[model samples]
Target chain A: MQKRNTEITVGMFVAAGIVAIFVLAMKVSNFTDFTDDAGYEVVAEFGNIGGLKVRSPVTMAGVRVGRVSNISLDGSTYNAKVTLSLYSQFNTLPTDTSASIFTAGLLGEQYIALEAGAEEEFLKNGDVLHLTQPALVLEQVIGQFLFSKAEGE
Target chain B: MIDFIRSLGRWGLDTLQRLGSGHLFLWYMVKGIPEVLLRFSLVIQQLQSVGVRSVMIILVSGLFVGMVLGLQGYNTLVDFGAEESLGVLVSLSLVRELGPVVSALLFAGRAGSALTAEIGLMKSTEQLSGMEMMAVDPIRRIIAPRFVAGIISMPLLAAIFSAVGIFGGFIVGYGLLGVDDGAFWSQMQVKTDWYDDVLNGVIKSIVFGVVVTWIALFEGYDASPTSEGVGRATTRTVVHSAFAILGLDFVLTALMFGEI
Candidate 1:
């Protein structure tokens, strides 16, 4: 009886350990929203990524509608091609919908934010989003600020 | 006054030269390596007896540590309006620094002192001498098991500590602290590098195990075979091992962070 009790306790501890590891892995992997949201694929190109990585959210008007699926660079153009999986239910994105790389907050993570365009035609799977803004380089912004300040002086 | 100043300066130079040779320490380390490894294996067996048997205490302590980290981190970050970053803060701090160090310290306090005292008592009773008459190597027979146990128990305890702590943090942070589960995890996913934190923790545990076990064994082996000697050895094992752990932590941190 004592042996059986000890075995049960050991089993319980092992089970708890396994559960904790699973929880940690799930948390670290961002395994939320595993249920497929209705979505279609669209592509955008940018000159610089600025720590923007795959699996980053694609937000429309501050609401996450999709996520970055893949990031690759065009061999000849030297442009980064970012593939976004947008929810199919939100088909309001026009053909001219523009994408911009923006930070969530000051010193926060970067995400691809979409600005819906006024055009009537909706974007389709495999559609290339032509109206795109690249990441704002911090050095460029600081340099511009300094240069403008110097000119004002 | 001139002679005093000159002597003080000479003493300082000699101290610097001794510190610079550091090879003397390295030689001692080399000489100890084989004995350490043998003792390490024996310590592993002892862990089966001591640590694996003490699962309840380790579990409860680990959970509490995790819960505290989460609750405290949440409150602090919320004050700054960065509540969502609780996951990153908890996971990084636990896995990188707190988990292994805290668990090892606890293990040393519990099992380390016990090992030292047990060996010290055996020495005082002349059981160690009896083993020597039987041609049994006391270092391998007596000291090795505790040393091996210490090394094994530390990593296992560290792993449990991290796992429980993360879970506890999650429970408190997400359940009570009002941080959204999704936001918490997303922040963690973005900030954490598994190789950097988890692997670093394991490496630290290995080094900690070595240091704690070695100190315990060394003290026991050198015990004066008297009651007073046993008491002194036990105290030294705990005190010296604690200092060694702190010093090695600094060295490892510097090396891991590329300060070396």
Candidate 2:
């Protein structure tokens, strides 16, 4: 009976371990999505997106409202096109709400930062964001400095 | 002086002989793995003994490690005005390196020593000889099951260590420290990749499991069936497994993520 209890507890231990791993994998790594994930899509274009990836959060005034749903290259315009998924609660972004890619902190992940515009009209699904500021490339900034210094020399 | 030199030479020869014989023992023990499949009870019992019983130590150690990371990472990051990235540092460190390497070290000390001692005790008790007299292969029944169990339990223990460690970090970072709860989790999600970071960690733990268990069983099976021998074997298991875990960790890290 004592051995049986240890076995049961051991079973529970293994089960709990597995459950914890499942939660970490699915929740943090996003291996699965059970939610309806109710949200609408909006698109923005930029000239450069440094280290931006799909599923990058879209934040409005420092609050996460959605995520980057897709990224593509505009062949003709030579621009980067990004699709944003705005959650149903945060669907009130004005048509002119500008999107810009920014780093959250120094040496941190890249995310899309949204700035709400004063327009009374709100953006809808498949609507394109007219104003976008490209991602700031730190390497480009450093390279520019080096070139300028060389010219001065 | 000449007599002492001859004795020293004999001692060196004995050590070499033991090493060669021990290698053979390990080889034969591993070869019994196929036989283990037909005898599931043996493996299950050892898994419970080795993996399940060792959970508390792994968890407590993992929790402390995460708390340390949270506390230390917060202080260092706050200096750079990036305290919110605590989750990133904690999860990445735990998942990538500490989870596998530390847990293996702990497992070596806990389960590895226990395994060596138990097997050594069993040998000294003549139970192995009794089985052999009954025309049963002790290697097939005894060592293989424990070996297989260690291999199975190791990765699970590692995963548990990492997952719980992350929670410990959450407690320290969100509950104690003033980091924003959302930012802590969101930052981790954004930063950590499943394949490159998480899967590689699991792989590392699996590798550690195989190597550590192999050493534990090898030391036990090869130790002379005596009290002093058992004690020595147990010590060797811990020392050998620790060194192997560290050396393997460095090599695995380099192969998985290093520029070279």
How would the docking of model 1 be graded? Answer: incorrect
- Cα miss at B14, model 1 (Å)? 17
Model 1 agreement with the true structure over A1-153: per-residue lDDT tens digits: 655555555455445545544554455533344456657899999998887987788999999899898999999899999999988888878999999999877777789999988899999999999989998878889999999999999
Output the number of the DockQ-best candidate.
Answer: 2
Worst 10 residues of 1 chain B by lDDT: B21-30
lDDT of 2 at B186: 76
Task: Kindly list the per-residue Cα lDDT of model 2 for residues B1-260, writing each as its tens digit.
Answer: 99999999999999899879877877887799988988776777787899888899998999999999999999999998988889899999998999999999999999999999998888999898899999999888898899888888888899889998998998999999989989899778767777778889889999999899988988887778999999999999999999999999999999998969
Give per-residue CA lDDT, model 2, range A1-153, as digits (tens).
Answer: 876776776678778768867766765554432243757999999999999988788999898788888999999998999999888888788899999899967677799999999999998999999899988899898999999999999
C-alpha RMSD (angstroms) for model 2? 6.4
